[model samples]
Target: MSVVSTDAIDKWLLNRKWAPRDLSAPPAGSDLAPVPGDPGMPLLGHSLEMLRLGVRYGLKRYETHGPVSWVRAFGITIVAAAGPEAAQVVLANKDKAYSQQGWTYFIGPFFNRGLMLLDFDEHLYHRRLMQQAFTTDRLRGYLDRIGDVARRGLAGWRPGERFTVYPALKRLTLDIATDVFMAADLPAADSERITRAFIDTVRAGTALIRLPVGRWGAGLRGRKVLEDYFRRSLPAKRASDSDDLFAALCHARTDEGEMFSDDDVVNHMIFLMMAAHDTSTITTSAVAYYLGKHPEWQEKVRAESLALGESPPDMAALDRLGTLDLVIKESLRLVAPVPSLVRKTVRDTDLLGHYVPANTLVSVTPWVNHLVPEYWPDPRRFDPERFAEGRREDKVHRMAWMPFGGGVHKCIGMHFGMYEVKYLVHELVRRFEWSVPSDYTVRWDPTALPIPTDDLPVTLRAR
Candidate 1:
């Protein structure tokens, strides 16, 4: 594993004819126009800058070169699309020009054939069949498990000065996923191992050296662990008629008699499990950070949560927390769980008047778009009222606020994920009131999924 070098990976990729085409020449005297802007540095390109600045790098590039610009990153030239218009084009995918294969270059090794990785009719087919797992009845069952798990998890947290909320919330969400999705309660050691596996799998996407070295090697090992674990558990899930998501996927069928194979069930389970827990953890952590910064909003949301009584609120009751809903939306906008949506051109395409050739990687930056002043006024401010009835700023455009993505490939487990976050927050506010120092601001490490660099420390007082 240590023998594999970055240069070796690059050479291997090039030798296998899997490397991106070199688009160094200008498209002159042709009707099709070349994408404008600079590809920073050699080999590495703007990837280092992107990691350092996060969405701000895209915002800067957008400022210099219009909505559509080409930038080299992650060993390829990506057509960076900024603002809501670009998001509408890429996400809507009206012409069927874009393919989900772009994600294949990144996470496919770990989460291959996952729903997000499927394209065209195949994606629709699997999504239709999987819809049964997230129906109202199923979501309600998930909520029950979430509430019980949340209470148990929160009870363990010693409320006092300087608590790192992100890690606690991350662990809590993973536990909820294990119970609600897997329908099995493993011992603490096993649960911890599974959780670390998930973390490694996700973090693998942004490894600087794609070769099997250090963390990247662990990620490859973790993927195998997950594959073996899921394969081993498949028999039990299929034999039992448990209402958990694992069982649902095993038995899920469409009106047309479509059903997933055993392999399909295992693959989808791994992807869904990662998506369900990690995104929920990010959203919940952001909400906690914002609520801590703004006590007035915290008190307002807490009041709403308190009205629902002490016991865990059901899915229906959870929806009634309007203020909390606003906060969640704002938090999602602020710290998008999966910030940028990547797509590869299946054929030659025209995006915002710039010509993109086939097999090109196109990135639509929602994280930066969410902060654009034109779309979102006072973008940096933590104003949840932007999503309130009177404002409804998100309605400015169909793709303006796309934290869950849009069009055919929007997150299928969105409802369940939201319910999980709201339930956890409700339990959190009811049990303790937390706050961060006014002068402090979170530093998001955007290497993979956006996570706080400092683990999000805050002072917690028992209610």
Candidate 2:
């Protein structure tokens, strides 16, 4: 009888495609001593690990070292910080010391200095203008617009057919963002064009080697395509104030009466579209995967949808859908859309009792904290009840649930994101009964958020 070799088994589990062998060691000059595990290749750092393995590497490092560890990725030194205290210190206490510009620098040439990429006063100024678009009254208006688009998108899906939900949901969200934010009726063809451009752009963010005329070049070309397309639409969008967020941007101003120039509006619109569509797509897919795998939770949400009925439920009704809310929150915890928050140290600072040198890249990984046992029980299980009343797995630590991130820089469209996912799930459960295949397994692609490696296979039946 032939026996399986332990090395072969180890190699099989650590498949280089998903898990790189090069990331199995830490770099010198970096104080990753607090944490154990590989930080990845020389000159490459943990960049590939961050892209391929998602949050597993950080969690392992945190589990071994402590709340803080140092590592290098993509030729940059990163300090991985975990735990509630660490989270509070980084996100709340001293944001000025940590800038979001470090991670977004690559995308800056493509996305421009959008809100999330800006720091200090510039971030504040832009955030103030963006806030107007998400006001209570504005969100109510967006609810009507978002609901119509969501329902229409769901209605178009044929029941019982095995389709890739991520791409479809991405198309759906992109269309919704364009219509609700730009007041632009992007035909399916144009929507696909724009979505493809974004996919390429985000893919470029994770590419290690920028070959001559490679993904990076393609991304730059894609950005030009996006910028040109939006620039043409700017005049029409700016011609009159429409209810769409693009319209809001056209006329948005600070207290000093400053407003975005036509160029500013175009760039900002592209950035907003990318952020909303990508995050919404990932989070929606995660919730769908969990619901498909667990029919009990699916039924719980279906009943809530039934109560919601044909009309778009008001904010109160939407908020009262507590069971569904818990499931969405739990899904985010399990596979956060943005697994890691990257910041560059503006000044030398001490983090978790270590001297972090200036220019060091500080990374706070939500994927790690989400799995830490101290904050969550059975960190690997799909227990939405943990988020429900009494259990409150998230309540264990403020930083425990950072799927949407935290602080003033917290996702401005968070409530909107939650509402969109909740409504999308409500509509899906109301229209169809679905479940994951018996032998289905999900692999995470850490490149562009945590997406199902296999398109999230599911069997759907008409209700």
**Number of clashes recorded per candidate:** 0, 2
Residue-level lDDT of model 2, residues 1-463, one tens digit each, is: 9999845653443443322222123335656323333455567765655665567656656765678766666666667777767777788845378888766755666787767787877888888887888888888888888888988888888765586777778878987888888877887688778887887777776556765377788788788889989888888877886898988888887879988788767777778888888888898899889888888989988898898777878777789888898898888888888887778878766676566666766778887878888878788999988877788878877888888789878988898888878777877888888888756767878876677787876777877
Q: What TM-score against the true fold does each predicted structure earn?
A: 0.93, 0.90
**Candidate number achieving the greatest TM-score relative to the actual structure:** 1
Candidate 1 structure quality by residue, lDDT tens digits, 1-463: 4588745654443222122333434356556557876656678877776776677666777776778888778888788888899889988889999999999988988998999999999999999899999999888888889988999989999987889998999999998999999888889888888888899999888777889877677788888888899999999888998999999999987877778998899899999999999999999999999999999999999999999987668877888999999999999999989889899999888787778888899988889888888889889999999999888999998778989998899999898889889998999999999999999999888888999999999999898
What is the C-alpha RMSD, rounded to one decimal, of candidate 1?
6.2
The segments of candidate 1 whose C-alpha lies over 4 angstroms from its true place after superposition are 1-32
Give the Cα error of residue 271 in candidate 2, in Å: 1.8
User: Which residue pairs come into collision in candidate 1?
Assistant: none
Model 2 regions lying over 4 Å from their true place: 1-39, 93-95
Give the true-structure RMSD of model 2.
4.3
Structure candidate 2, residue pairs in collision: 23-40, 46-73
